[model samples]
Target: MVKPANKPQRLSLSSLKADFSSAVSRRRLVYLLCTFFVIYALCYQWQFLVSLGLGPDNIHHMTVGLIPAVGAVVLSLALYWRHLCIASVVPTALIAVSWIVTGPYLSYITLIQQNTVYLNNMYDIYVGLYLFAILFCLNMAARQFLNRKISAAIMTAVQFAAFFIIALQWVYFALYHSCITTSGALLIFQTGPAETLEYFHSLGVGRIVFIALFVALLIGGLLFANYTQKTLPRTPVYRKILPLLSLLIIFPSVGALGEEIFPQAFPIRTFIDTHDYMERSALYAENHDGKFAALQAVQLNPSESPNTVVVVIGESETRTLMHAFNPNHVENTPWLTSMKEDSDFTLFSNAYSCVWYTVPVLERALTEANFYNNKEFNSSISILDMAKKAGYKTYWFSNQGSIGVADTPITLVAKTADVSEWVDQELKQSTMDGALLQFLQRVDPNEKNFVVLHLMGSHIEYRNRYPKEFQVFNDGTVNQQADFDNTVLYTDWVLSQIFEYAKENLNLDAMIYFSDHGSDPDKGRQPDDISFKVLRIPMFCYLSEGYQARNPEVVEAVKQNKDKFFTNDLAYEFVCGILNMQSPNYDPTYSIASLQWKMERKDLVTRFGKVSLLEDTEF
Candidate 1:
């Protein structure tokens, strides 16, 4: 038999109040707390820049930056007024997109303000814009799909979750981006509103601030829940102001479409446009299909075939800090100094990076004259392609990320090479010399090979970028001198090691090395920091003793033309002097190693759409 069950009495108001007071809903408090905190922090920090008065140049960015905060506040208020507790996905999606699209330009503020800022070349600007837009779209989609919450508990949990993830990201960026204030500011700004909380963390005050904000949000959330229970109508004040909010959003959209969207989406034919060149020129170059009326290359045939010629394309390696290139710097390059003493090596003292950035110069330098056209050539004709056509084994080894997983120029360059190797994925980490070892092991001593090594060289995140074990300077933090010399020394050591391995294992003939472009380490100057150290890089053609002994004329020619050769002239002179091919446009005056040649044309655009031959004397 079953016993009859007795029902318990309903709880009293007193008991309910006691329970609520003892255990406040931690989750509900977090969202309301964080929401106001972010709003207050952004306005407070950016007040100085706001006071200076933003202008036409940055009006678009300022608009982009301001809208998200305004939207968030409006949406939150609307939900509260409607007696609603949860936010819909649509408003969240709008917030995410607005936040991300504005991401690329976040750094523009600091870039304009920084004294040491280097203006991105015209080509770099276009590339960066395209890249940033695509990345923003992808990130927005991911965030939209990933963050879903229909409950107050879940939304509060999201606040805490987002805070920690963003904090971790900022910490890594700060450490890597140490001392480079402009770069650091840009990085933090892109990471979004939450990073201000983390910036306070870096200052050791984040915990107290976060906790105080957390408590405030709890009180706000409780008040919101209580108000929603009453089913209160939205105040008339909001209804009257709705027209203003609508206008604010619609006006910006219309203006953006007119100013930026239309021209970028549909450009008319122009004789010279950098964006057009980036989009279509690669195709024209590959097929030799463009009106390339401006340039040509002459080929050089070797008297005796050599086993291998290796070219190292170093990144951000500048002469300003290199002792071998500038006497004022301390002796930081013992290996390079010794290499310079060797009779077979020809060093050019006056070499400069034609462009301030990497990819444009990389495309221009390696692609010969064809790189400067406006056709849609997704595939490129690099030196590796030419070498492969000439029946030599061509290889490309790089430490740079494959800008895209598929259909990117870097990948195309790799595929065109007979053998291509890219070491880093997600561009996690790399060094110049480490990327080179990929090729050294595979090359056969008996085969004729042409290998190009693209190094990370002295790229930013200057301190952790190089291995700590390899660090020679004890300044405890990174400076231009220590960071650069450490990187240079590491690169020098790697080159020396590679050279030794080649000497022992292969019948190597020559090695040519140069940087894609140099760096302006002085933090507050423009790109043309006239100090020779910034523009200068070491360019050397080192011939093996056996090769020099076997082919003295080639060695003598290099010595004679060392001073006159520009990187632009290298492809034409090299192809004519070593490969022995002839094109109708080939002219030795411009193609040869001697600095005596002049670029005959002046008005034609370079592949990057910059006016080439601005002055004949520039070469």
Candidate 2:
């Protein structure tokens, strides 16, 4: 026995090989998981990390922390690269790419620039990551059962669809400098074929070609990567673990937390919100007739004489960009600027739209339901109803869309007028606001008239909003700000035309002008990224000598409150007060033209009272 022991136990080659293989397997497992963790963190938390690292307050952290953290991540990724399974890694990478390429990351950056505290918090990051993890697990499970060819086909199709969506979002961001939202989707649903064509055409050939090429290359590369991927030998443990992980991730999203978490995901969440909006719009339409019928008539107190009043509702006109409001800006509103010298003309220094969208803003601006009143929108009576009750013939002339697939709440309010006319009968053309002047020509001078002129002022595709002659800011170059300035100029011209016609022909006693909502020239009026400029609308009242004489106290009140904070949702009450009409809905406190009118800066709000104007530093 001793002689046999003395020979020394020789290590078996197969045993040594088995030990080395086990260690390699363990390292590969650790690396594969690290890869998943890295992708997950980048997909959901990059925006937060970026904001944290690059924020003005984080300069010290950037020097000491961020750079080292980035280096560590790079090293980890390199180590993980060799162990990555193509079946898992490729789809995850594609999903991560979608998150980056789509509008969210860009929008996040833009928001952070404007406001340092705009980054998503840890809670939001976790929710997004959880949802993404569930999606990844499902993708893994799909690959586990399907053959390599079928898996590749499915993966390619998914990536292609994702690429197509990303391209659409990219194109939208390029044109609007913002993300496509539920409101944007509503605009799409409301748009007619001709308008849709114009929208795409506005993207120009260069952008169109770039988007097409970019998408084609992305899809082609993704397809190649997916198809050329080599199938790795999957263990029974892996097969079991993948299904279990998928079930675990899916359980939370399908259970109580699903409703809250799932809607936080992009593209899918956008689609969900759009669908919800459609359903709400349909319900509103269905209930609108009854609501209209149920509206109570307000008591009419006539003026000393039959007055011809015109309310000019401008679209996407921010006072911050108007020369009359911001003297530092370009002189695009020379007519309004000169009108300021007139004794009868009064320009409100602080005026905001209750909401930043056309439909919601107009719904409240034209109705008795204001942000402060808490009145139901459907139940409230419109300005048309109030005017008609006072025995004035009401007319609505709009250069904007009148009818889409469904009647918007604003359109419903517009239709309540004695006559409703849209420049584009089918919303099929890009008609200038000048076309609305033709409708004003039909006004009967003898009758008491209340006319609404809704102009497409400074809306998107700003170049199309004006004629070639009105392109004063153009230097034979593509400048969005210049195009916007040209639109403001054109709008000023349009306003002057409307005012002169009403004054010279229709015995215009009083004329009021206020935009439905304002817009950001750089970033169109996005609800989520609302700035004070987006709510800071241009508001002015032009009182003829006759109106000034008859309503001197009201005129005095208007002059006094011109510098006070006013939101357009109170336009109804202001109109009532100015016209010397007595109504149950009339609240002198809300009316800027009433001696009792009062509003504090703290009380001011926008986005239908959801956001405080105090949040905006510009306000």
Best of the candidates, lDDT? 2
Model 1, span 465-574: residue lDDT tens:
45667678655444455766787878777778777776677666678788866665444134433333344456777777766675555566668766652544244344
Instruction: Give candidate 1's error at residue 419 in angstroms.
Output: 0.7
TM-score of 1: 0.56
| Ten contiguous residues minimizing lDDT sum, candidate 1 | 264-273
Candidate 2 per-residue lDDT over residues 1-619, each given as its tens digit: 4564566678999989999999987987777567655754464355544332222222332233333223322333333344356655555445545655444565454444322112222223334334334444545555567777787778777656645655677677777565554446668767999997897798889877987888778767766666665553477755675466457545654452365533554444556555665665576657756755655454434455666999998988889999999999999999999999998899998888888777777778888888898898777777887787677899998876554322256677886788887765522233778878888878898889999988878876565578789979965434267888998999999999999999988989889999988777666434577777788999999988877777778888999889988889889888887777675656778888898877787988888688776777864
What C-alpha root-mean-square deviation, in Å, does candidate 1 show against the real structure? 17.5
Instruction: Quote the positional error of residue 339 for candidate 1 in Å.
Output: 0.9
| TM-score of every candidate | 0.56, 0.56
- Residue 246 lDDT (model 1): 40
